[model samples]
Target: MSLTQEQKDAFKAIFIETVTNFAQQVGQATEKVFLQILPLTVVAGTEYLKSYEEDLKTKLEDCKTKSQKIIGALSTVKEPEKVEKTGDKHLPLGELLGKRVQRGEDWKWDDQDGGIGSFGKVVGVKGNGWVKVQWESSRNENRYRWGVDKAYDVKVVEIVDDLGDIPPLEEQIKKPTSWVIGKSVVRGRDWKWKDQDGGEGQIGEVIDVCDEGWVEVKWKNGTVCQYRWGGENAFDLKVVPKPKE
Candidate 1:
């Protein structure tokens, strides 16, 4: 469903205000200072701005994940009707029919599966076994009728069901845990690192402060895991709580 006008307005207000604040903070004066220091930062250290970009993205994704989880939990009572799979849940008519011809629940796309070269996103569910999808007629596929049949292969695309509730402000805050031995965040960001929930490689202290990504984490098992910054593919960032709702 499209966002309600009020919701849209609220999002607009928050987004615009936050952007304005960021712009003011990073205004011309700040940019000049950054430019002057850029050479020194580059030579003496890795550009922090680049890493900070990732830091922002990580925090945003984490917020989204938390939102999804909370939405899922509160959804039972607040959004039972939302359980219906509209977009990605329902495959397109052609894709659906093609799947019927040949079957694949766990189907995967590889060098083989004829990609949805023509198939667009699934828009709505038509009647039984039929789904409406956005698609342009394929020249080689004999018009849109090429509706992926037994001929074409399948691939799954991820689509969210709907925009969940933004969540109460309190849920956005970070809670501390003392079960783990080591508590280390990214060099600059604030995601605490832990080992497998608890125990083993759980305790660590800063043996020495190194540059950028490297931090020494001692597991409870007394084993040291060395990281080269982006080593784990996932970097943690500090959590900033939104204003109380």
Candidate 2:
């Protein structure tokens, strides 16, 4: 009699559990045997376990061959699509939108270089091969063209999957409005300044609040510096309750 869908699912679960337990038991037994065999091989000399070793090696090879065949029959996995590292020729313009990118070695314009390791986000796509990018370091917008000297100069570092949650390029860099003195604040979730001052979760007092979105904070670890909190920069701080005075 053919099994119902529910019965089939129950059987599959039981089969998986049984196989998992069997694998664990086999692994434990094999480990114990290996431990015993190691001492025996050392104390009794290599020749003592030579015959059994050869037999085990033959069995292992047989198991590997059978496993390969089983895997080939069951698995429909194909080799992953290889990306060419030679140039950005493989990168399409459609894939680059809302992506954070860095300049590659092939970038020729020395005067327009956005520092060595600075990264930027693609905000707009221009005609020809040019793309508009909002740079993190400069907090300025710049346009870069692709396929310079046969190879594209842009190297994508990150892709912003959900564009709906993010604001426009112009809105992101504008000066923040909300800033008051003596407020307790912590670094935002997307805070990138891990090496500078105290890292994430380090609470500090907002010593000086600026209209330009930068706030001067005195960290608990005696670090006093200005950081971007809101507006044109990434929201770098979140207000927390004042400590029990």
In TM-score terms, candidate 2 sits at 0.31
Per-residue lDDT for 76-175 in model 1, tens only?
Answer: 5321122234444334442332111111243343312234343333322222233323332321111121122322222335431221333332332222
Per-model TM-score on C-alpha atoms: 0.16, 0.31
Number of the predicted model whose lDDT against the real structure is largest: 2
CA lDDT of every candidate:
0.36, 0.61
For this target, which candidate reaches the highest TM-score against the unseen true structure? 2
The TM-score measured for candidate 1 stands at 0.16
- Taking the tens digit of each residue's C-alpha lDDT, what string does model 2 give over 36-65? 555764877767688789999999999999
Question: RMSD to the native, candidate 1?
Answer: 27.3
RMSD of each: 27.3, 20.0
The worst-scoring run of ten residues by lDDT in candidate 2 lies at 172-181
lDDT of 2: 0.61
